[model samples]
Target: MLPHDDNPLFATFARAQIRVERGEGVWLHTSDGRRFLDFTGGIAVNSLGHAHPHLVAAITAQASKLWHVSNLFEIPGQERLAERLTEASFADKAFFTNSGAEALECAIKTARRYHYVNGQPERYRILTFEGAFHGRTLATIAAGGQKKYLEGFGPKVEGFDQVAFGDHEALAAAVTDETAAILVEPIQGEGGIRAVPEVCLKGLRDLCDEKGILLIYDEVQTGIGRTGTFFAYEHSGAEPDILASAKGIGGGFPMGVCLATAEAAKGMTPGTHGTTFGGNPLAMAVGNAVLDVVLGEGFLAEVRRTALLFKQSLASLADRYPEMIEAVRGEGLLIGIKPRVPNGAFIEALRGHEMLAAPAGDNVIRFLPPLNVTPEEVREAMRRIEAAAAELSGRPAEGAAEGAAA
Candidate 1:
């Protein structure tokens, strides 16, 4: 039962009716004293899991030192974090934001500005793909070109062209002389965890290079070791001129970054664009702490190991419960399962069994476990999933016999 009071919240979110009291590691405890295995990881934001001592300590230390300072002034923590980020990746420069949406906005602006400053002011249109989720800003919504998101938002933002998700021929045909850049997600997390093949990514890179256009990768969900790699672009060998990363970058802190090559960022002069709270000391502290753990010795390799173990279990579950699951897809910890049943019902079933999962496009359920989830917890998650399957299919439980196979 939901609380009956004068609720001041907006109706935008169709939220779960439970109130979480606390979260620790891989579990969330509700106000009613129910414990749930939180595989959602706060929709892929809790990279280091809940109440991580390192993250908490970083925040505490930074709060005690300094909380924020205008971008007009020098911020040592922000400079240090930027250096750390650039040291690990291909970006020659980095700009901070408060969320993935703003990072994407900066990426878009950077692309157009690059062409403008390069004397190709006509090359302002960006070629975007279908089934891509960029962000909620007006420009980003137009980039996605989804009617559901753009509905009632009259007069869509200009300078964006849409193409089918994996159709290289269509993409090539769609590009014109005025194209400024091509944008895509290496792994479409919200679009049912659909991974653009390595070959396709390389093809996009080739196309952009041939056309003298910038290549942008929206790694907001696939970055920060979510997909077994530091960035999904690493798996494809297709580096972007500009990259947008968030969700896991702050290990639950609200922060995002736009990474760009030296050439791509030439147009963003000191006053061209800025954010007040983008690189504040508090967020930078958490971001640096997250990078310390993610880019540490053998940390990503361990994440890959754990992801493989968990993915194999999911594949086993799909094989055993064909009536409930149609397919298992995605890379690493960003796994998606296309279920034969309604996605909403499946999510609710998981919830009923003391587990939490997120719904994605194309009737898929996403399992975003913590990067450091123990093997025992992975097995337990599988057990609960099996139980949910049994309940959904109206069959007697065979989980004990099937758990070993998983």
Candidate 2:
């Protein structure tokens, strides 16, 4: 064994102590035989939860047939998925990718190419909001504009400008003759689950139309039924010309896609852009399987109903534990709680109670349970949360002392 302090892999993520062996539904089983209630849902990627039967069967079936094939050959799964995605959303064309970052990259390229084909090569700059988390790529990090992520990364990529979020005046002022697109997340996932109001989204659509620039949505976290809708933009009635999607798109599988209107993608002809592993048979199979569940009859309605129940419970919990939780926020299953104590402390407390959550910007703890989570699961999570809050507030849990006495 290596030294306790040494690791062979890059020391990037501040990983938790437990070693997860396997998972099923909303629980993670550790190597030590401990089962934890999983609320992070693989950072909101496990839409149907861990090891969903449908996903498992699809992947297994695909593996037995073809694991991978070059993008040069036609893949029927990709064609079918693309058709379904376009029929369901505002896009008319879709480009497959392996991750959210690649989708964003493709979106950025599509927007610039659209302007170039329109005979305006200089109109390449894209406007983004402050407090956004696009991705970790060189271009996406530049678009996110967070100083911490950009720090030490030499010479930030050019053509991206940032403005105060929700500030119509600043956003308008920031737009210029060189602007090619306005990219935003309907709900900022890593930015403390901040949502752009419906009116603001409409205003953005109007702004883009008035300026003849494309509107791009980085829906990597808010799409695929996480926001009580097929895509969060549907809630606002402001359809984007280009959108980057990932996270739950493939349930637990690694996949992403960039969707665009036919006009927006007109410039991306043969040989302009391509990916070697994107749209592979395996990824396509899983993507199709995920859609099979997400698009099933009444599935999205159930997600909305469950989200309402969970958020109401969280609101009540915040009211009861004002000393521990400051507020509740977010839409659908993508919920966040602002803690009275440090967010890290609250996360650790939850972990101690055998519950898992993720931390976001602005000191918020995210509770991203699987979209198919049941009401009983939500109630169980609340019980653990109450216990954690009681401990932090120096109060005995509701029945803990009584149980001990008995």
lDDT of 2: 0.93
Q: List the residue pairs that clash in candidate 2.
A: none
Which residues of candidate 2, in runs, are more than 4 Å off? 1-5, 398-406
Error of 1 at 251 (Å): 1.1
- Number of clashing pairs per prediction, in order: 0, 0
**Residue pair clashes in candidate 1:** none
Report the Cα lDDT for residue 2, model 1: 42
Give the alpha carbon lDDT tens digit for every residue of 1-406 in model 2. Answer: 3444687866677778889999999999999998899999999999999999999999999999998888888899999999999999999999999999999999999999999999999999999999999999999999999999999999999999999988899999999999999999999999999999999999999999999999999999999999989999999999999999999998878899999999999999999999999999999999999999999999999999999988998888787778888889999999999998999998898888899999999999999999999998887888888778888898876632232211
Q: What 10-residue stretch in candidate 1 is worst by lDDT? A: 397-406
CA lDDT for candidate 1: 0.91
lDDT of each: 0.91, 0.93
RMSD of 2: 2.0
Stretches > 4 Å off in candidate 1:
1-5, 399-406
